[model samples]
Target: MNLNTFIQKKINKQLIFPFIILAIVSGIFFMSIGFRTTITTSKIELEKAVEKWNNTFTNMENFLEFLSYDNNLIDNTEKLGEILKNFYNKFQNKISYIYFSTSSKNILIYPETDMINGINPNTRPWFINASKNKEKTQITEPYVDHITKDIIITISKYVNGMNISGVIGIDINPSFLNDILSNKDLLLISKNNIILFSENKNKIGKTFNIPTKSERFISKNILLITKEAKGNVYIVTYKNLFLELLPYYFISLVSIFLILFLGKIVNKNINTELKNSIAMPLETLVNEAKNYLNNQTFDSSKITSNIKEIEVLINEIADMISIIEANFQELKATNEELLDAYNEIEKYSGELESTYELFIEKMSNIVEGFDENTGNHIKRVQILSEFLAKKLGLPKTLVRQIYLYSPLHDIGKIKVPPEILTKPGPLSEKEWKIMKNHTIWGAEILDGDPRLEIAKKIALYHHEKYNGKGYPFGLKGELIPIEAQIVNIVDVYDALRSKRPYKKALSHEKAMEIILKGDNRTSPNDFNPKILEIFKKYEEEIKILWDNLNDNK
Candidate 1:
């Protein structure tokens, strides 16, 4: 077969493999999207279940307060029984039973119409827990009652009106939660290690043993969620299968194997055709070209090939080489001129760099003239600011800017009277107000300098507290630029460490203790709690930087 004919046949055959791969990849992508959507919906439903349970408890609590007034508080067992019976009737299908108890003692049991509340469950695990535990309320797992044998979740609360009085407990059925957590096989375990509720019926009320494979993947997620810390939600997803997609995976794997087997047969056929069409023709052309070069009389008319493009390209190349030899001397002269221009451009670039350096040096001298300490302070603050910015996971460009602009931190202090700058005593209220204005003054100095705007913003607002009690403008929380917040922490660290006219330098440990006490402010006005937490995390490194800067000085 001709090489072109073989290649065309192979190209048509390759189309089949690509289409099959696309179908498999598309199937996986769609399945992934569907799985994620199901998980999100289930999460919303779980939240709703929690909300419904909370509201139900609140309603029962309101009833407990009302019943406490007339019913015997000292001998509440019989009265509680009657009250629970009423609740069962009121909510009907929503609530299955009402059981009241102290952590270790059962006060009452009331059952739904479908359940039998014949025997008292005073000694049951949930009842005993309700009677003794002083915690507000403990919700129990799903368990079958002794006589009625229906599954239910129990909630208990400690009674504190007069004396320790014991706890009141309520039981709820979990059939409503099943519809919501339908996406995954879910298991709700109690604090006592009993499975309270589960979509997987086989697991309900059973003790959980960590499966060997799931130990690493899901154990930590389960632990974190069970704690129920405010705003603490966790995802414990792992591989799973749906009823519909099971067949797709099986079929896809079989298809891949069959395609692989067929691919070997196709490849063998293509290889045989390549030897006859491509390899044999290329070898023949190379041998003919070598023979003509050895004979020394190259005639273009002697070379003819069945491949049309290769033949045309060979004929044009021979003519082109003859034209190149004729023009070689003129081309060499023009190349020399281009080299000279490149050298001149390099010289100009070097001069520009030298001029830029000289400008920076002159500006540095003028800005930090009075104290050599001013230069070191700027450099150190910039370093510290950059460190803080990076530690907080800021973008690289932002961190670089903070480092470059921190020297302008005290640019506003330049406007303060020299006497105040070196004052040995605490300033009066009026003088203090003047000192605080340095931030505002510094901002104005760098305001129009496009180069220093971010630095100016830091200088202007870094001293502002998280609680809106800070000066110039009482910008609070995230409203205060992160750059300013970062500079604020470093500024305080530097201030406390440096020898001042009024107070002795504070120890690094003491400085850290005060900043971290977080007693700074939240409601009244002060630093952000979350931001403060970030600062505290890097305290050790911050202290190291402070020590290094002081030593260098």
Candidate 2:
């Protein structure tokens, strides 16, 4: 051949061989795209089916829960049958039968089936499973129905009440599962690889061999979606690969011819179009990142770029923001919990104070009731002590302590003999000495209780004279606690105005006269001069209190 002809033939060979290879690759790519689309569509449909099945299972579970709460159905065969009939009517097509069995082996079946009696339900799998799982509903392994010969699964719940307790069961027919699979070749397999149900009748009740890596076509099996329901695994398989790829096969042939015509021009335009598509979206992404950093919030939904890389980055940022938001919500919940705890502590403190006040009032009543002074004497003493303490410019907390504790000052009188207390005449010197021991007795009674510190001090020292001549310890001047000193004056003033078994009730003016100036019976030197001065100043207020308290008389 001539040299020019040889060169032209070689060029033709090079061009033809490359075109053939490109056509083959293009055909493979188009077919792969079609297969991916088919798999995606199948996955969506499988999810919908799985969700429907899950909803149905949830409905069955809810119904079982409802039956468990029916106390009337438990142990009452007639009521149980009535309820079962209602349940069967409500789900007649989906359920094969409804029955109940008690712990005592008594069985009740709806639709009036004649079964053998005296069979222990505790030995049954449904009862055992329901009893074992006390916290949730239980589902038994699939079994053939004795009457209809249809495959069925039983859902059971344990019933609990005073006199009625047993297991309630409902047999569900899985025939309706075919509608969820939409006539697809789906198998409901147990965890042990036993096929519970299948679209193909022969496959049911057979052991299934799960596909291994070597046996499965990874690309074709992408259409298979496995979902779990009530511990059973469902495998949905899509076949017919060739029919799904037919349209792509024709389109690939057309693409090969177009590629030969436009191959040289396409490469130049592709880079330009790619840059235009990516540039604006990339810039927008950068601006969004800046905004997210600056403001700590980003509208991820607004980021709708078609570029794969930008979309991926946007999704990652959205995930990070979601994590931060979740952490913020958790922190907010923790803060609310802390606030609740603080409020609880405050409520407890107020309740404690109120309880302390109530206890003090009760103790005062016991002492007064025992002493037989029935005209609100303890109440008047508490009021008068509180008034004197405040007028003496004591701190509010100390004044409150004095108010609550002063009423219990004479609790020692309980130890005194009733005859000695109720005597209408002056006592013998020995009896008077016994009466003086009440102060020591009151102190002993109130001691060791940290909550009654003021009560103990007042009870022990209220009779101690300011000049060191009083009974008990004989504490003088500032040596005695101010609480006791305040109560001492108030107690004596109330006693003078009150009618005692031993003495006529003195007038308020006479009581003040004896307190301010020395009398034949008592002297001003017996009280703290400071407390006595404040008392004289507020004597009118004290008289008003006595009059008001005595008004009930």
Candidate 3:
């Protein structure tokens, strides 16, 4: 019947119960598998810890055997000292001290101790036990050191040579032994039922009575895997099953949640498909028809649907829309032709503007040539002006304007007498007055064109000073256009560096010094302070531009 009812019925009848069953089954299966995996992983980790402890204890036994090989135990004092030094350095953190006890009442200790030579070696349990059993190494129970007062275990071997019978003993910190036992969930227990090393420090040095009956042991829940180390036995216990299964339980919970969430998403998508296949297509066709009636334009693409009734309805609406769209397209084609004609007219207008700009640029160049300025000088000023404008963060359009119009800064020189403009000697005050009026004349010349607005500003105010002592308009500080300020500094710098009719070209260093520090006709005050700072920052770049454009070079 209806799409919504059909989709809901399909999901309820086929999907919901099946998904619920699958979620329950997957969660139970995952928990079973995961719990077993976690238990196995714990067992492997515990075994690794035991193997590591066994390896370390074996190394100690090997070291003791190495020490027993020495025949001249007392006479080879330097050799023994070197051996002890190496052992102490390597195992210093674990072994507090290592010493050799001889039958002659002498003790040689590593990390030298204050014990006197006359002390009896037989009085010590490690020495007595090792000396008694010459074949096997002895590991004595934990004892407080007499000197350091720290808990220590002694690993010793009895040594017998031609004239020597003694014990080679290494006193290890019990903490090092505890580290191995505790890491593996193990306890080091003595034959006397005393816990020597355990993960729980309170149990160490404490005795635990063993139950006589197997039933009692089972009731007490005592389970252990034992490994004998010398005389002591290490007991490994299983980790808590609940704690080990936590991660697996968490994963199972997540999997169930994810399954349920996916079921909801699938149900949502079914409803969405119903809407898209029936309701959305019908709504789109109605809206498109309304848009065609009101706005004379409609989407011509066919409306798609999966439902037979909806598809047939969409086809009928599409046929009516097609006829309306045809009339609209005919009008659209006519309007496009009119638009093309207007664009063609605009293209011709743009070409005329470009021609006018080229004419202005050529006129500016002619004026510069008449003023005895080199073509290269104008080009260099344009480069320097553009650099300063960009460094000052001017917009790209303005920066381009500065580059294009900077050469026109002296266009006013066209009205000045040629002889006066190219004078090889310094100008008199009256002649300077006339020369200064060129700024006013240049502004007037470029005043009529909107495209030359930037050029007009530069021509009028290029000679103006930041400190207000400049000519023509006497504009000061920010009163001058930034474009004019940019061209002014660059114009002055290029003029100083270029060989003019009246002045020889100066070195870049000398020219910069005069520009920054002031000369006869201009000073640092003549330039904008910000512009000056930008010029200084890019001083090297400007100098390179100058050198490359130098006509004399």
For each of the candidates, give the backbone clash count: 17, 0, 0
lDDT of 1 by residue, 66-162 (tens): 5545434535455556767788688655565565654444456565342323444466655665556554455655666665576766665655534
Error of 1 at 250 (Å): 7.9
Worst 10 residues of 1 by lDDT: 224-233
Poorly placed runs, candidate 3 (over 4 Å):
1-324, 331-356, 551-553
Q: Which candidate ranks first by TM-score, i.e. highest?
A: 2
What C-alpha lDDT do the candidate models reach, one value each?
0.62, 0.76, 0.76
After superposing candidate 1 on the true structure, give the runs of residues whose Cα lies further than 4 Å from its correct spot.
1-42, 61-86, 99-121, 141-143, 158-168, 177-184, 207-309, 312-553
Encode model 2's per-residue lDDT on 387-419: one tens digit a residue. 988888899999999988998999999999988
Order of the predicted models by TM-score, top scorer first: 2, 3, 1
Ten-residue region with minimum lDDT total, candidate 3: 211-220
Which residue pairs clash in candidate 2? none
